[model samples]
Target: MKFTEELREENKDIFQAIFHHPFVRGLGEGELPEDAVAHYVKADYEYLNTFMQLYGTAISQSKKREDISFFQGQVAFVLGDEIHPHRNLCEYIGIPYEQLQGFPLPPTADHYRTHMKSVATDGLLGKTIAAMLPCPWTYQEIGRELKEEFAPEAEHPFFEWIDFYAADSIDETVDYLKKRLDEEAEAASPEDRQLMKEAFRKSCQLEYAFWEMSYTKEDWPIREEVLK
Candidate 1:
């Protein structure tokens, strides 16, 4: 089996958990509280900044011309294409898009960013890609599956969110990333492949946590408790 396939098989349960998470379900049903949606938009907008930086790290680590180009293209996509949904969500909720630029990262977003930064800065391109893959990869799956299952109407609050993630363009990116990851795995030592697998699994786990964090409108517990 391909390395990406192996990674998926190993973490299939996490994917299911993400798909079934309350935030995901709420999105499909358009039942999420506005506060939760607003928090998600702000948090995810901030997270995308770190996401783009990781792609830059991937580009710096690239030796192949095509790899550099691919990473650069992804960075552009995150900036140009991926952020539109967040912007729409912000407008829908009356938050200024510019405000998200300074929005504080909640605990979960901070931890996930820290995790990706560790791998991205570890000087291994393959591990960085593995760490980053689950975001787009799982999101594509969730968007497609939710759209299919819920058949959300255009009036649904998150219909655009679903459509953006379920787009053919996202599928193409996931396919290319999987192909590239497999190619990287073929040239890797067994130890390196093992590390890649671990990175992928950890990312899958974090993906689940992200949905839960959004669903709960998670905040810094210490701050909340201190104020209480």
Candidate 2:
């Protein structure tokens, strides 16, 4: 089996737990409370924009030319093609670009950002890989669930976004990470291994929280809209 497939198989329980989470169900069906949905949509918009910005920062901060070049290519791909999913999501949520500027980021967003910054600043490729692993892995799992349980016609705007992040690109990202992890492990000290493991667990917890936050009455207002 491919490494991605192997990893997915190994993490099956985690993936199932996330997909079955109420937050993910809401996203799949668009059944979240209106205010909660809107809050989540707005939060997602800000999150993606910030994510792109931080990728730039990571690239610039990379001391190795190879790392810089690799990230530069990723940046170009994200800006050129990967951004369309976010644009589609913004349109679906009725959020304008200007509106996102004033949006208040959720506390989870801050935690995620701080974690990313720490990973980048630490300059350990293993730590960075550990921090980044959750994103593509989670996306791939979401895409699989969307395809299995959601609309096949792709009428929902969020479906595309899910497909984009969780489909083929996720496999690619995981493959890259596996190679990097191996390389980093070969060179890592015991302390580095401990740090990487801690980062990985923390990142996974954040991933779970991210999905949970999306389903709350406090964050999403779709349920209220339905009631009204």
Candidate 3:
């Protein structure tokens, strides 16, 4: 099997947990609390902010001009589609978008972002793309799955959210990522290919933590009172 296929098979348990998480389940039912969604929007903005940097790194490091073009296109997608919509979400959640930007990231956000940076900055080009693949690919997959199961109406709270992920654009983007990853791994030896799988696996695990953190509103251990 190809590395991406193998990675999915090896990590099927975590994938199941993510696909079946209460947060995702709630999204399907439109039963999730707005507060949780609010927290997620805030944290995810921070995530996308750092995510842009990683894409920039990938663009700089890529050896092929077409690879550079793809990464640059992804950067634009992040800004235009990924990040800009949060402004309206901020409005819906009754917080100014500017205020959402000011909130400090929770520990989970930092850990995932830090890991992404480390991989994109330090890993092989193939592995760096490997690290980046899970987010879009997995999200769109879940979105497509739930969109069919829920068939949410236009007015549903989470409908637009589902639309974002289930868009044809997302599928196209993830397909590009997957194609690149497959091509990169095609000629790689067994040992080097394993590194790509490991990177993709770790990113998938972090993807789960990211959703859980938003739903649980995970907080850092330090207390404000104790700090003083």
lDDT of 2 by residue, 1-228 (tens): 533344456556667788788767766775545556556665666666656665666566567787677667666765677656656556676766456455656777667767876776786666776677776667766877777788545677476776676677667756666676666766789788767767766666777777667556333334446887
Among all candidates shown, the one with the greatest TM-score = 1
Best by lDDT: 1
In model 1, residue pairs whose N, Cα or C atoms come closer than 3 Å (at least 3 residues apart or on different chains), thus clashing, are none
lDDT of 3 by residue, 114-185 (tens): 887877766567778888888887889788878999998888767777788899989888887778788889
**Model 1, span 195-214: residue lDDT tens:** 99988888888889887788
| Reference-based lDDT, each prediction | 0.87, 0.66, 0.81
**Candidate 3 C-alpha error for residue 18, in Å:** 1.3
Q: Please give each candidate's TM-score.
A: 0.93, 0.76, 0.92
Off by over 4 Å in 1: 224-228
lDDT of 1 at 44: 88
Off by over 4 Å in 2: 1-14, 53-66, 217-228
The number of clashing residue pairs in model 1 is 0
RMSD of each: 2.0, 5.6, 1.9
| Shift in Å, residue 157, candidate 1 | 1.8
